[model samples]
Target: MAEVKLHGFWSSPFSCRVIWALKLKGVEYEYIEEDLLNKSELLLKYNPIYKKIPVLVHDGKPIAESLVILEYIEETWPENPLLPRDLYDRAMARFWIQYGATKCADAIGALYVASEEEKEKAAKEILEVLKILEDQALGDKKFFGGDNINLVDISYGPCAYWLPALAEAVGVKVLEPSTLPKLHAWAKNFIEVPVIKENIPEHDKMTAYSRSAREKLGKN
Candidate 1:
């Protein structure tokens, strides 16, 4: 068995974050793709509380939460060094990461609920969050942590992969080249990284999944 194992859902950006960090650090892991609708007993056993994916099992010890798992990967395998060495720089990165994790995530999550007829309002909120990420957080940086992809970049892992399909499904356009120039360029560059490029779920696969999920949500 591989020393490192990741319990993830293929279409989940959270899962992709863990996957990217592991691959970037050259960590060989056995990925277990979960069916969110029918989570496995192993997943339940590993992450008994949250029971959510992006769980990294190292030497049989499971670590839950994507962001938490990411820091673990950085600490355990510090070869590539995802976070900056400087304390202040690392703190800045962590701040941006945590902010998005709390506020932006809450806004984006509203897209999942169907009965909320104010889709545009939700989209506007999500766009405003991205706007801050671009203007205040990201700016003109090629990546979140300057020239190199760091923990901060890894934290925003889902934006590059799923945002396109999400925009399509929801009838919105947030990550567009014209709308968010710097961010759009960053997304392109972020995905081009070899570690990320190899492990991302196929576009068609994710789009199909998103559409299906939306349909199910619409019915209820």
Candidate 2:
């Protein structure tokens, strides 16, 4: 059995982030496809707290949370360095990653669950968040890490693929080319990377899933 085992769901951006990091690091691991509704015994054993997918089990020791798992991967591999070498640069990278985890995620999640009357307001909030990301974090860089992708890029992986899919499903335009050209272009470039392009969930499937999820949210 492989020492590195990953339990993940197909349509999950969190899972995709780990997948991308592992692939970039050239790590060989066993992948266990998890059903969120009927989670596996091992997954529950591994992550008793959250019982979430994207758990990275290395030699029977499990690491829960995608960001924590990502840091673990970077440290263990040490090849294809995801973080910058400079102290300041690395700190900045972490800062943006943290921002994505908090502010960006909250805004996007709000938009996802927004009612018809609140959709526009939710979208505006997300746009404001993205604008900051574009201006402060991204700027004219091809990727957040600049030239090539780093932890910041990986951290914001959902914004590249899942956000667009979510926007389509919700019938709201959040990352528009006309309005936020740089961030829009960044999304396009991020997805086009061979590693990302190959690993991401299908857009149509994601949209359908998002739409279904919204319907379920409405009922509850």
Candidate 3:
């Protein structure tokens, strides 16, 4: 087996996604925790463009971006497939992952720092997104990928863990059971997966971090 090393931060959902994928594949790896504020020389060397966490180094080759690294993992270690076998389902999964990448940040940013009225507006927008996700993507499935959690669920890991903390910090609710029950249930089920449940940051710690992040957003 080739040597695998993961560069990540514990609190980052992006990092957690990579961790979950690696664990699911039963890949053995050395984990290097990077301080986002200081950024290690190895992380700088590996991901020069993004200078980001969650870089996967396999046999001295570096792969960056959580989603890109996920594809690489799936392709490299094909034992436990993270994507569908059918070509079109794989494409759809990628589409939803990309969609989450583009829209999720915007939806979360609304509550990151906003006036009371702004929170209301952002909550509504987030609900709309969740509604679309529940109806079109997740539906009644336990995960986005029917019975199994796949790339789409991994892509939205932040929504599962981070968004609730953010919403709590900002005093807004987006993933309510009443409005978006499927998505709400999906988030619950996603986090409860043994690997995910074990690896996620503690909720109180996340809430504290969310508060700090929101404060920084307010300043900027």
Candidate 4:
């Protein structure tokens, strides 16, 4: 029997990325919940470089980073292919996923912890980023991978869940249907997927945690 283990934090989008990929591939593995506040010895040992969660340990080897782990999962378990078979399509998916990680990810942090005076600017920045995604990356596709969810979709999983939750917690919205009709609709569809819907952190709990984190950041 193949031994697979995943160490993750429930509230982390990066962690969710790995979770979604595993679920989609129908791979059963052990899940170890980490306390980000008090890091576990195994987590530290497994990921000494980053000491981060979402580490996928197969047998005795540990793979760190959400995206890296995702790729590993796709390659290892080829049942439900998260990445495309065509070379060009796979390259395109990687490009967009990198764009999302570099561009969209930080914008989320800025919006989430934006002070009252900075909120408008942060929201505007987020809107611009979302616009790029909608117009260029997403276009009119139901999902990033057309009909079925792909690695690109999983890569941007945070936008489906955390983006809206952070917007609500911050009392400003950047993904309204009127402004980003297609992306907004896509978000709804992304969340409705059985695997995604089942795996995400609860909305109310996330909101409360986000609000608390924002407050803590304000004090520091």
User: Per-residue lDDT tens digits of candidate 2, residues 1-220?
Assistant: 8999999999988999999999999999999999999999999999999989889999889999999999999999999999999999999999999999999989999999999888889999999999999999999999998899999999898888888888888889888998899999988999999998999998899989999999999911
> lDDT values of the candidates?
0.85, 0.92, 0.88, 0.90
Residue pairs in candidate 2 whose N, alpha carbon or C atoms collide under 3 angstroms: none
Ranking by lDDT: 2, 4, 3, 1
TM-score of each: 0.94, 0.98, 0.95, 0.96
Report the lDDT tens digits of candidate 3 across residue range 1-220.
5499999998888899999999999999999899999999999999999899889999999999999999999999999999999999999999999888878777766667776568888888888877887899988789998898888998897788888887888888788889888888999999999989998999999999988877777722
List CA RMSD, all candidates: 1.6, 1.1, 1.8, 1.4
**Rank list by TM-score:** 2, 4, 3, 1
Tell me the spans in candidate 3 whose CA falls farther than 4 Å from its real position.
Answer: 115-117
lDDT of 3 at 29: 95
Q: In every candidate, how many clashes are there?
A: 0, 0, 0, 0
Q: Summarize candidate 4's per-residue lDDT along 1-220 as a digit string, tens digits.
A: 5599999998999999999999999998999999999999999999999999889999989999998998899899999788889999899899999988888888878888789888889999989988998899899899999999999999997788787778877888888899999999999999999999999999999988888888888811
Better of 1 and 2 by TM-score: 2
lDDT, residue 70, model 4: 88
Question: Which runs of model 1 end up more than 4 angstroms from their true locations?
Answer: 114-116
Model 1: per-residue lDDT, tens digit, 1-220? 8998998887889888898888789899898889888999999999999889978999999999999999888899989899989999889989999987988788777765534476778877878888888998789889998998998888887888787887667666668887789999999999998888997888878877777888887822
Clashing residue pairs for model 4: none
